[model samples]
Target: MSRAKRKIEHIHHALEHDRDYYNHFDDIDIVHQSLAKLNFDELSLSVEAGELKLSSPLFINAMTGGGGERTEQINGEIALAASETGIGMAVGSQMSALKDPAERNSYEIVRKNNPDGIIFANVGSEASVSQANEAIEMIEADGLQIHVNTLQELIMPEGDRNFKTRMENIQRIVEGVSQPVIVKEVGFGMSKESVECLWNLGVRYVDIGGRGGTNFSKVENLRREKPFSSFENWGIPTPISVLEAKSIHKDLHIIASGGIRHGVDGVKAMVLGGEAFGMAGTLLRVLLQDGRQALISEVEHILHEVKMALMLMNARSTKELHRQPYVLSGKTREWQEQRM
Candidate 1:
């Protein structure tokens, strides 16, 4: 099948399926302070990564692209939300656009809609440095996100078999691109070991696309003749992965994703060391089910909740939000206890 058709199929499956099992955000808590001296209106957040800054940390991460006009329209609506909110936006894998010039408009719609917002161009790890650069230029991206999905690819009949040179490939892209290169897991989470590997490769930004939000293993299983249900519940939860990334290195800017269902979850991620939180599945569902206004409403609702959490934590800024106290419990605690 063509990339556009395949992209549409993936979106359909994600939209219709019940892929969530354990989010693990419930395993961590951003302890509240009743004596919070800060007011909600005073809470100003700018996620800092070294010298890089996001005026607003809330963002819509890429989940679909290059699936023809339908995908393009979906992207346009999401980009409209991002542009309206002043948060960053990421376009899904531009590989289809790279292979077929006809599909270029599908990805380019994001740039056309959100002309001034911080936009991220996303690609698979298999892409070469030149290919990565092209993906960036296609959308005039602010940064490039290189997604690693070994299991997702393995399950798909048309997916890649070679992950051997991914590290070297990432290093090349980070060196070749003028924009910052961010390595992200595709709903499989990132461990301290993985973060260390990327850090050693000179990649400073990592998005822990943890399990529990969208399970590609389960999604792909539905596409197969006989599903591999055993692998469905794989990978570390989002909160645990954030904890693991926090333990690895303080300088490694972390972007927490996967199963971040609401703004409260976003707040929990920050306390666990996420510089910013990404919501793909929830945002996509809202847009598809209720249209553009509903999507904007959802984003505003989450941002409001984040402000409330900040007020409760007495955090005056995103930097101070991370300094507030939090604790891990339940299975997430067990997971960390074994590793720590």
Candidate 2:
């Protein structure tokens, strides 16, 4: 099948699948405070990342693009939702658009819809300076997310073979591009070492796209001649990945993802070290199944739930949530200890 056809298939499989290794959520807990002096309306979660000033810490993450009519329609709907909600959003890999100019409108629809909201342009880690620049220009991107998907590529039958140029590509992009380049994981999660490397390379933003979200291994395996079932459950949990990234650098802005299905997970992610939370699967489901109005309602509900979580802990902001006392247990804690 063509890559564009494969892209749509990937989305279908992601929606109808459940391949999470275990309950990573079981590993994280935020201590609730008995007293909260402020009202829910007083919660100020204004997140300033790169040049984007979001109303809240939640953003619709990168997914779907580079196909024909159906892909564009999906992106258009997702963009409209983002525009209405006033949250940051990202378009999936623009490589298809770059290669085939006909697909540009599919990704560009995001910018056309969300003119003012924070929109991130995305590309693989192997993208050159020109490709990255073109992607950002294509969307008038507020920021650029260079996703590292080594494991996903390994599972993909037609994926790139030589993967040694990622660091060099990232370094060049960061140095050459005026927009802030964020190094992100494609669901496998980011490690301390990798985060530290990005920090040293002048890349200030990182998205720890941990496991427990969409399983790309499963998505890709279904397309291959033979499935690699054993690798399906690979990678660190989302919260653990956030802890690991935070351990490497205090100043790097961390965006948490990977199985962040609801507001409660977003709250826990903030406590664990996420400055901003990105929800892909859950938000996608809501938008696709229930339509735009329902998607808006769901986002509003999720944000409200996150605010309640903040009030429960008396966290006036996500920064405060990060400072709040929290405990890690179960397999997450054990893995953390072993890593230490």
Candidate 3:
């Protein structure tokens, strides 16, 4: 199939399957403050990711582009939602757009709608400096996300098996681009070693698109000529991945993505040290299944929930949520104990 057609299929599959595959394993907790001494209206939600300042701590993450009319419509709707809500957004892998310059318009529609919003252009980690630059230029992105997905490639029939030069390639991109480079996991999650490597390479931002979310392996498994059981469940869990990344580079900005749902989950992510959160599957479902108004309502609902969570925690702002005392338990606690 052509890259563009594949792009739309991927988005549809992600929206349909993410809830079943990703949301089953984890839960987020919020510590309520009975003496919060503040009203919900007093809560502050503004936070910054790199040079981009956001009205809320959430962003519609990288999903799809470079397909045909349907793909353009999907991107346009997502962009419209982001623009209407005043949130940041990341377009899906621009490799297809890079391959066919004509497909660039599909991705560009995001910025065309969200003129004042923070737009993040994306490409695979395998992309060269020139390709990365062109992607940023095409979207006029405020930042760039280079997604690493060795697992997805392994399961993909057309996957790139040889990723030996990814580190060097990422380093070059970080050095070559003026924009802040966000090192993101395309669902396999980031290990401490990988986080250190990216930090050393000057990646000040990282997105732990951890395991407990979309199983790219499962996504690819469906397309396999012959089914493979080994690729079904792979990679680190969300909370554990965050702990690992924070241990190595405490100062690096981290955005938690995979499997995150609702306001309390967003609160737990911040308490666990994630500066921002990205929601794709849940938001995309509302967009694809219910249309743009539904997606906007869902986002607004989450924002209100997040603000209420902050008020309950007595957090005056996003930064305070990071420092608010909390503890991890269950599988997450056990994972951290073993890792630490």
Candidate 4:
């Protein structure tokens, strides 16, 4: 199948797949403070991920583009919601556009719709320095995300087999690109060792795209003639990935994603050291099912929920959430103890 055809299939499978599977965020609980005094009106939802600043900590994560007109419409609607809510948005991989100029408009619609919003251009880890620059310039993106998805590629029917130069490619892009470079996972989470490697290669922003949200393994397996069911439950959970990334470096900015469902989950991620929260499957489901206005309302509602969570924790801002107390239990605690 062609890349564009595969893009639509991925979207369909992602929306149809059951995301109710345990993501381990439930294993975390932020201790509420009653004696502490803080006003909700004074709380700030602003966050800084590397050099890119976002009005709200929650942003529309990479979802779709470069499939065709359908994807262009999808990206346009998502861009509109991101613009209306004043949050950052990342387009799906621009490799298809780079390979075929006709697909360029599908990704370009994102920048056209949200001219002033913080936009991020995404590419696979295998992307070259030139491809990365073209992706960033195509969207006029504030930053660029070089996503690492070994598991997804293995499961993908037509995915790349050779992965030897991914790290080298990422290093070249980081050194070659002027925009902020974010090395992210494609839902299968990152380990402390992986985070350290990226940091050593001059990468400061890491999106621990943890498990429990959109299982690209499952998505790709659905497209395969013989599915690899065992790998579907693979990879670290989002909360655990955040802990792992934080355990590596104090200065490494972490964006907690994969399986992030709501505002409460976002707050839990923040308390665990996620500089920003990214929601892709959930936001895409909202947009495809309920339409653009509904998606915008859902984004607003999530922002509201984040504030409410902060207020309940007696935290004045996103930064203060880190100072607040939190408890980890179950598999998440076990992972934290074993890993950290």
Candidate 5:
């Protein structure tokens, strides 16, 4: 199938197969402060994720683009929502656009709609330095995200099998690109070793795209002639991934993604040492099912809830979330103990 058709199919399967699986954020509980001096109105949501400063810690993670007009509309809507909400947005992989100039507009619509918003360009880890630069230039992105999806590629019949050079490619991209390079996972969360490797390669930002959100393995299985349901529940959970990334280094910026459902989950991620939290499946579902306005309202509601969570935690800003007390219990704590 063509890349455009595959892109649409991926979206369709993702929306149809969307499930409310547990992401382990529930395993985290922030200890409440009764005599907190901080007022609710005084809490600030502003956060710095590496060099990029965001008005809110929440961002619209990498989703769709480069399919066709449908994808262009989706990207535009998402960009507008992100702009309206004062959050960052990352376009889906731009390899299709880089390969075909006609598809460039699909991804370009993101920057066209939200010209001043913090936009991120994305490509798979296989992309060469020139190709990565082309993707960044195509969208005028503030940063570039090189996503690694070994399990997803293995499940997808048409996906690439050669991933040996992904690390080398990422290192080259980091050195070649002037913008910040973010090494991201696609539903298969990063290990501490993976985080350390990226950190050693001069990568400062890492988006631990953990499981519990959109399962690309399941999506690919649905497209396969012979389905593999066994691989659907693979990879580390979002909360666990956050812990793993943080365990590597305190200076390493972690963008907690995967199955972040709401603002509470976002707050939990920050408290666990994530610089910011990203939502792709949740925001994409809202945009598709409800409409652009609904998506905007959803983002606003999430941002409001983040502020409320900070107020309840006796924190003045997202940076202060680490100073607040939190308890990790259940499977998440076990994972932390074993892994970290």
Candidate 6:
């Protein structure tokens, strides 16, 4: 299958089957503050990712590219939202455009719409350093994201299975690229050991694409000709990944993803040491179901909720939220205890 066809299939599969993988691990909770003196208007949300200074510590996350006209439309809307809100955005894997130059417009639409906003180009870890460089140039990205998805690749019918040379590719890309290289997981969260490895390799930003949001494994299973139940529920949970990755590398930039829903969840992620947050499944649902205006309303609602949480915590900014103490309990606590 071609990249464009695969892109469409992936998006449709994600919309249909991603929700089943959302494990309702309710034991993770953020204690509410009732006696707070801060107001919502005083909350600050600016943060730096690589060379770009995001108005808010939030990104739309990588969604899709190379699909065709529909992919262009979706990316255009997302870019408009990012530009309007002053937040950064990431484009999905650009391998399609790299392989077939005709698909370039699907990814370029993002830059066309949000010409000044920080946009990151995404590619898989298996991609060669040359391919990675091409992907960045293809999108004229502010930064580059290399996604690691061992589980998804194993389940994906057309996915690459060789993982032994990934580090070599990462090292080459890190050394070869002029822009900052961000190593991210697809849905399976990055372990502390893995985080340390990337840090050692001079990679700065780490996106814990934890399993609570869109389960790429599950999504792949749904798309597979013969689904495998054994690999369906594989990966680190979102809260646990954030906690573990932070414990290993406190100074590194960690973007919390996977199952991030409302403002309170975003607050919990920040308190747990995430520098920023990624919202994909929720935003995609709104975009596909109700179009651009509905998606805009959803983004505004989440931002308001985030501001409210910050105010309650007396956190005047995203940086302040990181300093405030919060306890992890239930499943997240158990996972941390065992891993730590």
| Residues 152-267 of candidate 3: C-alpha lDDT, one tens digit per residue | 88877888999889999999999999998898997778889889888888889999998766677777777778867586677887767787888886679988888777767777
lDDT by candidate, in order shown:
0.87, 0.87, 0.83, 0.90, 0.90, 0.83
Candidate 5 lands at a TM-score of: 0.98
Tens-digit lDDT string for candidate 2 (1-340): 6868988998898898885757687778888889778889888878876565678899999998987888898889888888887778888999889888998989988888878888999999888999999999999998899999988888888888798878888999999999887888988998888888888888889999999989999888888888998999888779889989989867788999999878998888888888899988888888789888898888888888988998998878877887888888889899889985
lDDT of 1 by residue, 284-314 (tens): 9999999999999888888888888888888
Which consecutive 10 residues in model 1 have the weakest lDDT in total?
45-54
TM, every model: 0.98, 0.97, 0.96, 0.98, 0.98, 0.95
Candidate ranking under lDDT, highest first, comes to 4, 5, 1, 2, 3, 6
Q: RMSD of each candidate?
A: 1.1, 1.2, 1.6, 1.0, 1.1, 1.7
Encode model 4's per-residue lDDT on 1-340: one tens digit a residue: 7889989999999998877456698898788777758777889999865687889889899999989999999999999999998999999999999999999999999999999999999999988899999999999999999989898888887888999988899999999999999988988899999999999999999999998988898898888889999988889888999998998888899999988889999989999999899999999998999999999999999999999988787788898888888888999999878878
Better of 3 and 5 by TM-score: 5
Q: What is the clash tally of candidate 4?
A: 1
Question: Where is model 5 more than 4 Å wrong at Cα?
Answer: 18-20
Count backbone overlaps in model 5. Answer: 0
Q: Residue 269 error for model 6, in Å?
A: 0.8
Q: In model 3, where do residues sit more than 4 Å from their true spots?
A: 18-28
Clashes, model 2: 1
Clashing pairs in 3: none
What is the TM-score (0 to 1) of candidate 6?
0.95
RMSD of 5: 1.1
lDDT of 1 at 182: 88
